[model samples]
Target: MRRSVPMQRLDGLVDPRQGLGAAEAQARSARYGLNVIIPGVRSGWRTTLADTLRDPMLWFLLATGALFMLIGSYTEALIMLLALVPLFGMDAYLHRRTQASVEGLSGRLATTARVLRDGSQRTVPAETLVPGDLVLVRSGEFFPADGLIVAGEELQVDESTLTGEAWPVRKQVVEQGLFSHIRETAVEDVYWGMAGTRQLTGHAWLRVTLTGAETLYGEVVRSAVAGPHAQTPLQRSVAHLVKVLIVAAIVFCLALAWLRYHQGHGLVDALLSALTLAIAALPEEFPVVLTFFLGVGVYRLARRRALVRRSLVVESIGRVSCVCSDKTGTLTEGRLRLTHLLPMSNISEQRLQTLAAAASQADSGDPLDEAVLSNCPPPVEQHILARFPFTEDRRKATMVSEQEDGLLVAVKGAPEVVLGLCELPEAERRDWLAAVEAYSNDGHKVIGCAYRTLTSEAWTGANQIGG
Candidate 1:
């Protein structure tokens, strides 16, 4: 891959303001091919049949049958040909079923992408995207293609699927001359996003550099296709053993042929007799015996509440040493419950609960808020005076409630944001911040809550302060 160039240099190659025109895009799409990843050649009856013909055992059988036919041994040739009927049928059926199942699944993951075409923004199929296209990505949307970040704001991406990085990466737009030297900026920071990664926050416009099977994620898929087929150690051993047996049978046949020729028999007759001996040398029921034992093992495992997906795995069951899994929803129940309550003031826990409940939205779609409201009773005779809905920019929610005593303004949000709005003393403020850090470090999601007493004048001006 070429090193990332400066945006100014890139601007000369493709228009950053208008992007590629429709005519040029169509021409390039035809040249570059569709933006689709072909992990492996699609399996079909023809490929399955070809693969069956490539097997070593099948080759041995075919050679033996040919020699028999050449010597006019009609009955032996027919028997050898008939032996392959069941094997070929089984191989073709399995391959066709697996291929159809994979093709059906690929349909569910196809996505629509937003791109700039003909100097206008439009949504199109992700596979239609080409190089040099300007693509827009937003929160909750997966990246359409691999590209460089031309412009962005607070853009954070979850690359867990690609890099196994659990935390979201914050992406920033590079200014002019940032890549002038090429050695200053990191490659990852220069490139915008990759396909299959999700945009977790903010928005960005990327100049598509690679698409289709050439993309990073596409390369991963391609590598899987180019990789060796999965096989158990036992299966590999059995295959090797079969090859050895076939070679030994061929050697014994040649020796028998030599002895018959010395006994004054014709060359054709000697070869025919050797071929018959080779046919008897192989165990025709080997596959059936192995299949029967594996099937019985699978049944036994099923009776013990263990589901085995493939019979080949039965032989490798004793090799399992360790199992790893994600902690969320696997090691834990993953259900939220009210665990602890912290009140910064001298107020009792009951007072805090009532205050939080009064400020909480009854139908709030947040699980934490739901847990809080469920543990507290509604405030008596309290009416909502003003409300400020939560937004990405604010990172907080505010509510003004009017009670018999006075009007109260409640704030609940990120610990840092809420702490900034509170009027606590310096010493008390440090304590609150320390508590917040402690909870955060313990892997607990903390929501800071604070309130202030508001007079009539303040309540009237609530709208100005975004209450």
Candidate 2:
């Protein structure tokens, strides 16, 4: 069962028929703040400069430079100090450029949504959305915040970004009124849409329940910010080496100072000699060499149209052996076509496509659904009786259609999930599983589909299919 917190909160605050007044919307916006996901801010140039100066090698160099001046070697001291200027300047430049690039990308991805304010539909920046605001969600838009669906038509959302399941969940009206009006709700009479999920199909009026940091996406963003960052093996190794070098530098400095003092040198002169000795022993050129190699790698990647932001990432990128990418938009073109259909049963390819099409939402704006509908013949004089939309837990959606002969229940989803719902012979199931795996290995997006016909006994009494 789903909690009706969204409905309860929005009940009196927002008017389902009209929406929030202009003055009230402004007040709530001020109270709730912006509905934006604050990204992890990287360290700035000043912080980077401080970190570089604090390095054991840099510390040794600075100490050595001071010793040269103390011993009256003014030229040597000046040269040593000048050597650090270029290194610090280059590092600071890189940090500032990366920061600016990230800011530009973030600005481009910022979205606006159609909202009802003062009973007029208008578009506003998503960050301005607050609780009690009415948002008009349509196909192919990301939900701005968590909200209750006041009104919708065959609404289906793909929450794979949040739940990691590649299926669309249906949202409808709830029977028991969560709000005094707008009764139809979600799965098990709980009507709610989450932030960051894409609306695959349908148009709906959503009354904002939770906004900004109070929403689920906001919670995730906060959790990530609070969590400790995972260190790579290279980073850990480098850190350990730094600690070892710092300890070694201290010991060497102490030993050299004692030896110089025993040889009849003054205390200040002995300390200066020890400092110079320690700095000479340090690998001063190691950082420069590493940065040079990383810069080269970045240039090579840029030639191939890849942007490398951080120099430290070059080593990590080299260690990557495999690259996994999303199929629909990332690797392949946005357009998809159903080229082949392999059915386990005696059903022909045409029949299988027809059944799958019947279950798919034609205008859902989902690529897979659109592909299925495009390949299969258009439905004629068909009456959709009932539908059980897909959920993350169930992983499959079912549709009951009234045909000329009788009622047919169509099911389609991810291969393993849809297979679990049907009863199949062991040998046949094994062969079917093998086929799916074979297709998957060939880089095909395989979808499993199955159907069952009722003889006025099963679906008639139930009048609904449990998803």
Cα RMSDs, all models: 7.4, 9.1
Displacement of the residue 329 alpha carbon in candidate 2, Å: 9.7
Q: Which has the greatest TM-score?
A: 1
lDDT tens readout by residue for model 1, 346-431: 88888778777766776443445567788985675778888764545676677788866788887777777888776668898899
- Return the TM-score for each candidate structure: 0.63, 0.57
Model 2, span 1-467: residue lDDT tens: 45336444455754455688779888877876777755545686668887566545456557657867776779878876776665565566556655665554344222787888887989999888888888888887888878777787777777765555555677875333546654334334237777877788678778787777777666765664444434547656765775677679879889989998999998988888877776666554554455456667766776775655555666888999999877654555546678878865578888898889888876666767888888884387778888665555566667788887888888888878877767778787788889999988987788888887775456664424432
Question: In order, what lDDT does every prediction score?
Answer: 0.68, 0.70
Q: Which candidate should be chosen as best, given lDDT against the real structure?
A: 2
What lDDT score is found at residue 366 in candidate 2?
76
lDDT of 1 at 416: 79
Clashing pairs in 2: 172-185, 173-184, 173-185, 174-184, 174-185
Instruction: Give the per-residue Cα lDDT of candidate 2 at 392.
Output: 55
